[model samples]
Target: MNQFVRIQYVFIVALFAVVVAVSGCRSSTKTYSPEDVVHYDESYDASDKKKIVRDLVDPLVQDTFPLARQTEKPILVVYGISNRTSEHISTDGITDDIRMELLKSGKYSFVNETQRANIEKELNYQYSGNVDPSTRLQKAKQLGAEYMLTGTLRSIEKKQPRQVRLQKKTLKYYSLNIELTNIETSLIEWADKVEIVRESSKPFIGW
Candidate 1:
């Protein structure tokens, strides 16, 4: 009887522990907004950078076609932006932000460069023996981009030696340059740049 009672007690304790653990885990889980700024630092932040780039590119593209040509949105493909900065910055993220902004502005249509392989595979499958010929899409009917959008992100860092001991300062200048070029004419239609500067200083004092 004692052994059976001990087993029942152990089972009850384990069930209670599991319930408490689950409740604790559920309470610890959190959801954060993309626009939320938790903390600021000297280094570049992804969310902050996205916002800045979006603001910089929105107006430039909004007026690209003018008021009359707004209806005739041009097709654009993101050729890609190179990250020439010292740190590991997400050029893809910046490109995505710019694309989203342009999309929201309804100024241009975008081609998915990252999904080219998948798109081709799907097209191939549709052309295979499985899919119905009547429903299959025509070959070479895909819309080609009229313009290519590309850019580069570069940073210049400067460090100054202090005249006195235990004093130093560093300045980082970040620049994002974006250009849109006509594929057929080989002419740049639009070009713009955005800059951000961050400065860090250390004093001869304790924190």
Candidate 2:
């Protein structure tokens, strides 16, 4: 081949090799353990859950309000927190962390209502006579929940109007309202909420 033609061919071949190499390169990923305090974005995350748990459960237990009329630890079933946001956020973490904090305070006992079916199955199996009679659990002897802990997670988002700036900003307001209701009286014994406001800016063209 002519010198110029050979040079052009080599340049095209080198460009193709570079693109193929880039395309074949593996993408990188980072993993954070549960103990890691990492904030990848301004959206709701583990840090927010931790803050909510800390701010939420601490005050409830510290107050003078009687969580239970009796002297024993109140039996509480967490019905779950309803998510009233446009975003598909998982509120399970919020519920779990709050329950954990409440338990740590030694102020309440929790009943896992989510495992009703599994518990029913186990109880039925134990009563079916296949297991030892001494180990069999008594029927209809499960402790009833004296109080229900339920809440709702609400969020409102506002974006800045179109402007000349290269970065666009978004404002998010989040509120978590938690309530303790007496099962017999159908009254809210104690209620409180925690609010968070977050502002984030990102390039308009990309994240």
Candidate 3:
């Protein structure tokens, strides 16, 4: 009986040891770093558009906000971007990129028009309960935007296909037009455009 009990204890100890060893082996650490570069292809992906906006559009917009170096940081509102392209591109994503770049430059303050409804809902919810009366937000106290940013994304495509050779070539040109308008004065403070052209060749198989 003693020998049987000793054997059971040994087996349980061995199993626990194995479990600990496996758990230790499974533990790992991962490191993260900033991306060094990005490549653009024919596919209509967000990365390519973001790169274009970052590299080209950002600089043009920076030039427009030269007055940022002055004493005050201007307040601006993004009216959202329009997608007039054949491809189902992410116009809202592009608008976010533009807003991010502009904000990162420390040149302007932004009033998020897109989130206004959500903000109103939250304020209403807070007013219902769980919010301190003294610290509660007031809708009438909201800051007005001094300037508005608006834009459109457009694309032009040219395609040529040779049935005999089973070869096809396509050229796609994308253009982004943006404007900064003074809200009170109803004047365009700045405007510019950035364009990108992509060409691709592929074969039509078994047609």
Candidate 4:
């Protein structure tokens, strides 16, 4: 009986050791803040978005643009920023940042085009007499935006030729051009461009 008990204890100890080894071998993840500029490959990163916003917003609010010419805050509708690049990028992030910056400047007011359908639904409900007449919103009284803010993002990528180089190099150029256009006149009142160039390299041989 003593010999049998010693064998059981040895088996349990070995199993526990195996479990510990497997757990130690499992991969671990590191967390990063959203504001940190981390680059794992040759792609658009947080730094690019930050720089683009910085470069573009200042120009739009400068004296050369319509900011100085107009005293009243302009109502704006952000149509969208079209993505012409090959990669899958959420272009809304770019436009949203720009919109936030403009809002902070207190020179522009925005119409929420994305929520127009829901907005209409609420208005229709209110008009159906379910709510008090004094508290209900009127139909067809919504303010029209005077100008539209939109633009395009484009990228050009170049790679090293198929030579026997020790490392492969890729160069990417990105450009973002934004414009504020008058809805009535169809003329561009303000425009600015942000350009970024990035290069990345990878070793040819595998370890």
- Model 2, residue pairs in steric clash: none
The C-alpha TM-scores of every prediction are 0.74, 0.80, 0.73, 0.80
In the range 1-207, model 4's lDDT, one tens digit per residue, is 699999999999999889877774558999887667777667898878988888988876676776634788889999999999989988899889988998888777888988999999999899887999999977898789999999999999999999988999999999998998999999998888999888899999842
User: What overall lDDT, based on C-alpha atoms, would model 3 receive against the true structure?
Assistant: 0.77
Q: Residue-wise lDDT of candidate 2 within 1-207, one digit each (tens)?
A: 799999999999999889877775569998777766666555888777888888888776774756633479889999999999877888888888888888887878999998999999999899887999998888887789988989999999999999899888988898999998999999998898999888888887731
Candidate with maximal TM-score = 4
Among all windows of 10 consecutive residues in model 4, the one with the lowest summed lDDT is 60-69
Worst 10 residues of 1 by lDDT: 60-69
Off by over 4 Å in 4: 1-36
- Root-mean-square deviation of every model: 12.5, 5.2, 14.9, 8.8
Q: Indicate whether candidate 1 or candidate 3 has the larger lDDT.
A: 1
Better of 2 and 3 by lDDT: 2
Worst lDDT window (10 residues) for model 2? Answer: 62-71
lDDT of each: 0.79, 0.85, 0.77, 0.87
Q: How many residue pairs in model 2 have overlapping backbones?
A: 0
Which tens-of-lDDT digit does each residue in 104-160 have in candidate 3?
877778998988999999999879978998898876778899999899888899887
lDDT of 1 by residue, 1-207 (tens): 699999999999999888877773324656778777643445668765766677667665655545216677888899889999999988888888778887877767888988999999999999888999999988898888988989998999988865766867778888888888989999998788888888877666742
lDDT at position 75, candidate 1: 88
Q: Where is model 2 more than 4 Å wrong at Cα? A: 1-38, 68-70
